[model samples]
Target chain A: NAGVTQTPKFRILKIGQSMTLQCTQDMNHNYMYWYRQDPGMGLKLIYYSVGAGITDKGEVPNGYNVSRSTTEDFPLRLELAAPSQTSVYFCASSYRAGGPDTQYFGPGTRLTVL
Target chain B: DQQVKQNSPSLSVQEGRISILNCDYTNSMFDYFLWYKKYPAEGPTFLISISSIKDKNEDGRFTVFLNKSAKHLSLHIVPSQPGDSAVYFCAATRVFDMRFGAGTRLTVKP
Candidate 1:
């Protein structure tokens, strides 16, 4: 069902540049999240949305922004990329939260900022 | 401060042996725990999960055991196969927030 899909599997950006990582889930999930994973580090949440038009910042939200314009899509924006922002980004979705439901993840997007 | 941790960075075992991966969490409020397996160039996938109320859950060759008092959980793979080799991540959830461990790389040699 293409549980979750992300565009531009790999990208390279210069400092101060901006770009959006596209994420879409066809599972009709109500919860969506964006997370980044650095080498030898656990996945850190950057942002998440409860539903369409609702979003909230997470642990590592300083350099990233997210918008949930629709239930199926949640996109992350890097306004001014920095070297520290370089990491593998993942998008995940679940039918709902606060239960035993599992989050389905999409193939990660590798980003490198110079 | 890392709330969840996988002390072992990597583990190796023969293809036919039992492989055990351990995880520990400092937060007692975490009510749910999960295990995910990830391969290179791919996102992590759900392997197994256990609710704090239960001490053990089994699915095929995979089994997850939880010890609330110790705040520790483990995943066991029996008769490991080469296909089981990958990075394993342990995750804990409290309400809406979920935290993951750094991950333990497992290699099953044939």
Candidate 2:
């Protein structure tokens, strides 16, 4: 099964340009998350969803937005891209929360804002 | 403030040697600790984990030790191989919140 899949592995955006990073998990996970990783930095959560139609902001959710319309898909939107938003984005999913279950991660999308 | 930290930015070990990667956390509420390894151009993958209730957990060549009193934990790899070269990240979770450390890059020489 494709645990998690992300579209547009790499992309370059101009200032104020908007785009969405698509993520899908065939594992039927109830919990989905969007995280960004800067060079020499740890993964920082931008947003997450408990299930379909439920979402919440995370530590670094300021420049990003997410929507969970279905259990298998969670997409992250960058409304106005900025240079600071250049980083590697990752999407992950877990069967449930607060358990021993590990969150499976996707390959990651490299974004550069010019 | 960083909740989890991996002070050493990089580590190098000779083949067949023991590699110990350290991690520390500032939160006392963290009940679960995990280690993840990532290669270039890929997302992090789970390596091993330990719960706060236990001090140590072992799996084959990898072992994780937790010290609740010091808010520290470590991952030890025995007989380290060149294939083990990668960036290792330490993570801690409490209920629904999880935090990760700035990974430590490990270079194993054959």
Candidate 3:
């Protein structure tokens, strides 16, 4: 089912530059999330969407923005890139939340902010 | 502050040996726990999971044990193979919030 897919496998950005990390899932999941993983650190939530037109901030959402225009897509935007944002980004989806449901993750995007 | 923690940064074992990875959580209300495996340059994939209601869950060569009293859980891979080498993450979730551990790299040398 293609599961989840992310675009721009790798990218480099200059300070203050902005870009969107695209994520799409064919599983028709109702919940989607964006997370960042730093070296030797666990994945930290950036933002999440419950469904189309419904979004919420996560633990580490300060420097990122997200929009859920449709059920299949949830794009994460970095408004002002900073060196601290250099890390691996992952998009995940699940049929539902707060239960036994498993979250399916994308291949991940490697971003380097210079 | 990190709610979930995997104290071991890495673990090594010989092929066909047992590999045990441990995890501890500070929140006592966590109702579900999960384990994920990740290869270099790839996102994590689900390995196994256990709910608070149960103390142990087993699937094939993998097993997960939860100790509610201690607020700790562990994953055990029996007869580990070289292909099992990867980073393992421990995760815990309550109603809407989920937290992950730093991850433990497992190397099963053949």
Superposed by TM-score, candidate 1 places the C-alpha of residue B37 at a distance from the truth, in angstroms, of 0.4
Q: Write the per-residue lDDT of candidate 3 for residues A1-114, one digit (tens) a residue.
A: 899999999999999999999999999999999999999999998998899999998899998989999999999999999999999999999998866677899999999999
Candidate 3: which pairs clash?
none
lDDT value for candidate 1? Answer: 0.94
Candidate 1 vs candidate 2: the DockQ winner is 1
How far residue B7's Cα lies from its native spot in candidate 1, in Å, is 0.9
Error of 2 at A35 (Å): 0.5
Best by DockQ: 3
Query: Which of the predicted structures, 1 or 2, would earn the higher lDDT when compared with the native?
Result: 1
For residues A30-91, could you state the per-residue lDDT of candidate 2 as single tens digits?
Answer: 99999999998999989989999999988899988889999999999999999999999999
Which residue segments of model 2 deviate by more than 4 Å? none
Better of 2 and 3 by DockQ: 3
Q: lDDT scores for all predictions?
A: 0.94, 0.93, 0.94
Question: What order do candidates take by DockQ, descending?
Answer: 3, 1, 2
